[model samples]
Target: MPSTLEQLTSNRVKLTVEIPFDELKPSLDKAYKDIAAQVNVPGFRKGKVPAPVIDQRFGRGAVLQEAINDALPSAYSSAVNANEIVPLGQPEIEVTKLEDNHKDVLVEFTAEVDVRPDFELPDLAAIEAEVPVIGVPDEDVDERIETLRQRFATNTEVDRPAQDGDVVVIDLEGSRDGEPLEDATAQAITYKLGSGGMLKGLDEAVTGLSAGDSKTFSSELLGGAHAGETADIKVTVTKVSEQELPEVDDEFAQLVSEFDTVDEMRADIRKALESMARLDQAADARDKVLEAVIGKIDIELPQALVDSELEARRNQVSSQLAQAGLTVEQYLKESEEEAEDEDAFWTEIEKRSLDALKAQVVLDKMADEEKIGVEQSDLSELIVRKAQQDGTTPEQEAQHMMEHNHLAEWMEEIRRGKALAQMVAKATVKDAAGEVLQLDRIQPDGSITDAPAADEQAEAVEADASTDDVVEAPETVEAPAAVEEEAPAEESAEKKPAARKPAAKKAATKKPAAKKATTKKPAAKKPVADK
Candidate 1:
């Protein structure tokens, strides 16, 4: 087999591979043997039929197709290796020539692939980032301490009317234009005042109401039928109460926290805040540093790869909505984005896909230059965390990941994180106040070296926006059936996407959230398991 590459663009290449007849013979022979076992010949036993008999049964085109299917992957792999190209994802392979019945003719094919473009890295030390200075205010500590006390607070019945930060147990019904909506009534649901995950105007409508008091107010329905439409909201408060917070004392501190005294608890809270602020600073620096790096380089994107990533992202959201029993139109309405027409929504997806692809190419190259890799310990930790989140054991999650081939995606997330961490370390960091910020909390790999134990890694994840779109382990560990049947991620430009299940999306129309993570999902060519 011999292959040559043509540079279609800085980041795109067309590889033409010529497979000699000798190399094609194996797939051809295997195709005949497989077909022989499936067909019954009058004079021969199953699997014993000759090639000539099978060829006569099915035309050469049929056999040629089967052979080409078997040979394309290997040929594409060989061509990629021979050309020393690091592909962004799978290539679009096209069989341009088939030597079907010609015994001496070569089987030729062309594969167009997106490759990692070469770019120069600037000196990291020269890069500067501005972060807010770390300073824990006295009021912040007091509020946190009060919050801790509230956690151990008891529910005390209050005779007064409900107010902000109060709990109201109520029954409610919703109707639009005097027509009752189905699945639009609830009984004895406990709602926290100001915790408006339910609907708009809930806090204000519920406030100032006493037990046994009923009132009707107007609020937009959040979900179910009549989701986005304004409706007459009837709410009756069955109970009104306030949290009886424990006193700020030594005994209270001992019960609520590891600290023995209120002073100790407050000090720990202050320390934790300062530490987190520092982590945030380092995180900000990493983003700025990366953006600086990408700005210095030029990249001509491979349109095929960009299209794949775009489709992958769009399918990802569509799959989620389907699972939740929704349609794109309903989803758009529910997300408050009905105004964002289909063309505009798709165009936005394309833009994000392109940005993500561009960022990945840069990060991957930086990782290679710095020789960054995911360590066994880090991977194990990630596996353990993922397993816990998935409500399974580490061994089980690891085994599942292996079965479905997700380890590489996880490893790539870890590797790129490390590379960005290194970049952050070399940058000059200053607080918004112009003080030289000390990023002692950040490691070269962008992890918090001394972060507090609770939700430490989560903070790190929040800080490093670059890995925001990495497929999480639990998502990959979903039921095997879901995995196999999942819509294929962005397909190559050559393939058409599969039709989604024709389920009606009944979700109420709403606006899409601002800045939903359109993060780079430019990894393994699998249907993206979105978080």
Candidate 2:
């Protein structure tokens, strides 16, 4: 075998490979056997037909084509290794020469493909980024305490008209143009007034409604049969209940938490919030430092690779918007995004995609240079984190990884993440106050220790892929307050409604269906062999 590489561009290359008859003999023999089993001759049994007879029956070209196809994958892989090229995508292969006379046999082919461009890494120690000072506000701690109070709050039937924060059980009927919409009707549905997760105008319409009171209001259906259509909505309030929160005293503290006094509980809450603030600052530092490093180096990216990434991101965003029944304009408005228009949103997306790709390339190069490797513990930790994020068991996530052949992909993510940590660890990170930040000494509980926490490795694995928040497209949009779902009759009135998070929280939620462990078919290795 003989091969030669030609650099077509900074990020593209062409490889020409020649295979002698002896090198292809194994593939040729297998091809003949396969053809012999598939064809029959007049005097010979099935699979007993000789290669000569099969060649005479089907022409030598057919055998050669099959053998060449069988051999192309190994030949291409070997040529790539021999030339040490990191091809980005599938190659456009052409069989430029083939000779099959009695005395000599040979096959020659060329593959043109995009590849990683060579680039130099800057000094990590010179990189600098400043993150906000970590300060937990009193209001944030109070909010967390209030959340805990709400969890223990008791609901009681109220006699007067319903008010904000009151839970109401009502029968709802929606009709579009005077025609009843089955999907928009439900009975004994429980909703919190002013929660703003149901249909538009629902809060105002039910604000002064007493038990057995009926009110009709016109609003657009958020989901189901009349999604995005305006309908006349009639609500009959069956019950209204007001929540009675217990006083925040020592007894209350003892009941709701491990602390025996309100002061102790408040102290604990403040401590937890401070810890969270520190973690937030650390994450911000990681991203900012990585961004600063990227800004220092210039790398030529292949247009084809950029285009593919952009298309994937576009499709993902489009799918999310479609599922939420929103156009780009509506999503940006409801989400309060800074993008002024759809064009701006997509442009931002393109920029983010390119940045993520560049980050991936840089991290990969650094990993190779530093000889970063994934350990079994790293993989185990990754699986646990993935399981927690996906709301599945570790066993299930492990099965999914194995089923989808994601070990290599995830290992790369881990490797790149470690490389990123190494770079950030060496960089000079500072708070807005100009105090140098020591990331390695930070603990998961937000405490500073003499040594790095045991979980630091796990955190490092996540650092490289944090860009997924920017690059990985949305699976679904945060369901806007403008949307609502029809509840089934079998659902209890006290049951939480099946819908997106309230307008107050815009975090994306995963779909309810458990992820199926789907095994992907391996990609076809046979390249197009034309003679």
For each candidate in the order shown, give its overall lDDT on alpha carbons.
0.63, 0.72
Which candidate number has the best lDDT? 2
What would the per-residue lDDT of candidate 2 be over residues 172-265, giving only the tens digit for each residue? 8887778887867888877878667687888899999999999999987665433566889999999988977668899977876778888887
- Runs of candidate 1 with Cα error greater than 4 angstroms are 52-64, 96-105, 158-167, 182-184, 191-210, 220-229, 307-353, 370-378, 387-405, 430-466, 469-531
- Where is the poorest 10-residue window by lDDT in model 1? 474-483
lDDT of 1 by residue, 183-202 (tens): 45777777667655666677
| Candidate 1 local Cα displacement, residue 484, angstroms | 36
* C-alpha RMSD by candidate, in order: 12.1, 5.6
Q: Model 2 lDDT vs. the true structure?
A: 0.72
lDDT of candidate 1 vs native? 0.63
Supply candidate 1's per-residue lDDT for 349.
51
